[model samples]
Target: MSIWEEHPLARRFWKEGRADFPIYDMHGHMGSLNTIHLARAEADQMVAHMRRIGVKHLVFSHHHALFEPSFRNVRAWEICRNHPDILRMYVAINPHYPDHIREDLALFDSWKPFAVGLKLLPDYHQVPLNDRRYEYALRFAAERKLPVLSHTWGGSSCNGYPQLAEVIHKYPGLIFFIAHALFGDWEGAERLVRESAGNVYLELTALPGERGLLERLTASVGSERLLYGTDLPWFDEYQVVGGVLSADITEQDMRNIFYANVERLLGRDW
Candidate 1:
């Protein structure tokens, strides 16, 4: 049996620790490692996995190689549309691909789901954050009121954190979701949140295994600012989810961290 089925969390639609919780996995990629593209069945398998893990909804993003502007966001959109209640999407626009941004945004506007937000990966795409190329994307997102979720962590030796920090300062109203939440500078994330007056979003995907981190963060920032994500195939499973909820947080806080918070932020009941 799958872990979600085997665990007690599966028996209850909502845990006491997390009263009437509705899970919305806010981050993940849909493609496989061997194939350059995401096959339809493979994408379906991802949804099956989410279901098995009790994830009611997910905001699926595209892989970095597929983050082209000229092409349609078909893969991401298909996954979301296929499982309207189980998956949602965000366009991962490559800032360097200036021509594709408008088209991609138009597609997004047309499809229109919960649309957790935009996905940006400066390290994977080899572009430093705060480059002028992203200004258009940033400005566009700001205009649309779309949030930007960046895949930033320890591997980067560049100015990603600082440049992204600069972007935060540049656009006071732009909601930037910092994925991996500064693996290299966790404290820096805390400082940025304090300074930004809570305009910044610190996504927690890498710390589920470490129980203490969530508790520390919840106390520091108030669980309302944190969003639940699994980063998909790379880190999808109940062990992580359980560890995250099982951390030193009340079931109520766990429900907020895993469900209600994202629901409210993304403006969706499902």
Candidate 2:
């Protein structure tokens, strides 16, 4: 039998979801996308899903906010406001619109506890994360020590490891969450975590699908530097949770990944 077969938490999680292990999903998305269909993309539907899976908190960016040129973050603000108990938001920053970035940052504080940080989709936005256009938002996040979730991959010119390296070093104070953990390049992801000074975190969204990636990452960087993320509406929460529970890591490590690390990172902010 495998190690997880006899584990109490794993057994309970398999039987009744994780009622005892409350999760704080650090990376998620709301709203429907243009390219693909998402079954539970609405805020209420997502909240229902979270409750079913024992997810205590979720910080997400609306899909429209990331992809639409005209929409920006208006829907994100509205949705998060309505679901304040379980939802938080990332103010989406599109580098193409400097005015929108400035306007959003200017009004950010007013959103208060609802707006936890900023989201950068550099690859989709066609702007490198290290570019001058993103400076203002980066500077703002750094100054306030707020978290910034960037969509990073292995070899894309926009938010790839090279660009991330520059910005992470430049804005050390910024709590950086590397979305997808640089995707395909596992070695690069491990190196990025090893090289960074605690400010950088690897968010597990689509990663749990890979068999031993979680265990490997835990071994390399420890659980404290890793964060749980569902990429909700895009993936099933049970599958992600099962992946963690099934890993060879200890319960404490599971706790850290599910909620503890995020609680510490957000502090009293959430």
Candidate 3:
């Protein structure tokens, strides 16, 4: 065998192929422009790409649904139902719609059988990370033992690790996923994971330019607290996949970051 073929992670990404180590995509979206790209068509496209690259499952939240809330959630629910084995949902929560918070949580809870977690975008909504409104969803997730994925940036005014720390402290039972590795604050993201409660996990979706980030994070925080995700429709999957595949970590660390950590959040045996 060639030297490259001898490396476990290299073999998984190149030689051995998807059959042996299928990827579980932690973040994705159903194309928002339903008129031009229908939900089923978007689902088909996502599935085709997954098959092409050996991804067996996807835990996704719809882009439009994240903003539209109730209306698009029903559409997302239907799409998940159509591809039950391959697709899962993240109930999108927008704090701007405070009146809809409780009602939307109830609806999302009812679909708990199909959802993997909840997706929050405080930055997009122009809401602070520790806003009182989000506590509604946080409380719900804690009670149900569901994970929450929130958009996090490094130096943004509202939604970043500093604000997120408060939420993590308040609800220890709820697992919090810091989205996009602090939106490129690799070191800060690692520190957040280090200091936060066990329930907090870092989502690894940093771009390729941030070289050695994955290796550093794996060393500092260990792989158990890291989860792999590709902010799919907004960012190319190849970039996200390449970031992890190029990391100078062990095959087992790759396994933990790519799949095992997420399964842990879902309370599934890995």
Candidate 4:
């Protein structure tokens, strides 16, 4: 009965009584899961409830394309083009691909999504972040001022976080947001936050209100480096934002977490 196994991702909304809030589900995948599975149908129905609950947006990555550059970029474009209201896509670079950034940036130029960014899921892709193969993609993104969301978990072990760290340190100019807020490893994420300072950020998706996770991070690195994300369908909105809203933070902080940070990162007012 784990979240991932039993759809542990939906526990907060389904079980924690948070079905009413509008959820941004900053992190979710667009697929037939909702069409093929009854449980997923329930999840799709939950989207209307998300609107009621204050969930305004969903920043999604094509889970199937995370490992394939061409397919990932193409599918991401189609999805965003079709569902501009609720879904925005962040393309994944198969770093090893010949065209890399150009292949996707061309799509962005034509598609003009409200928010265009990148998602790197090194664990699933079996790529190492520090492998030096992603330099071109990272450099190109930095030059364009595009935000790159890297998958990091205290649990991801080696995958690509090392490369992610290297990319951040090397580019410094890139808007790098680490998803999963250290992936349930508060200490490691905190350390990265302290080290990155303002150069990098962390997304509060699965981490939610991990005890003193936010407080300690705020104290050390300032709350500005934190981005609010729900990992929708993966984590519950009520559990993610409720305790966070009640925490010892400011209205400005709340605003930043809810929308501003991501808006600023994506260069959009929303």
Give the top-scoring candidate (TM-score).
2
The CA lDDT of each predicted structure is 0.70, 0.87, 0.74, 0.63
Instruction: Put down candidate 3 lDDT per residue, 1-270, tens digits, no spaces.
Output: 743467666665575445366577777777765435443438877777677667667778887787665565767888888877778888888887766666667687567567868888888888897989888888989987787888888887677767877888788888888877787667777777777768888887654336877777789899898787776655555566667767777878878876777666664521
Clash count, predicted structure 4: 11
Evaluated with lDDT, which candidate comes out highest? 2
**Model 4, 9: alpha-carbon shift in Å?**
24
Query: Candidate 2: which pairs clash?
Result: none
Each model's TM-score, in the order given?
0.84, 0.96, 0.88, 0.76
Clashes of each: 1, 0, 0, 11
lDDT, candidate 1, 102-156, per-residue tens: 6677666677764656878787677787788778778877777687888777546
Each prediction's RMSD over C-alphas, in Å, is 4.4, 1.4, 3.1, 6.8
lDDT ranking from best candidate downward:
2, 3, 1, 4
lDDT of 4 by residue, 153-222 (tens): 7766544345556667788788788887766666667666666737688777766566766776666666
lDDT of 3: 0.74
Please tell me which model should have the higher TM-score, number 1 or number 2.
2
lDDT of 2 at 54: 86
lDDT of 1: 0.70
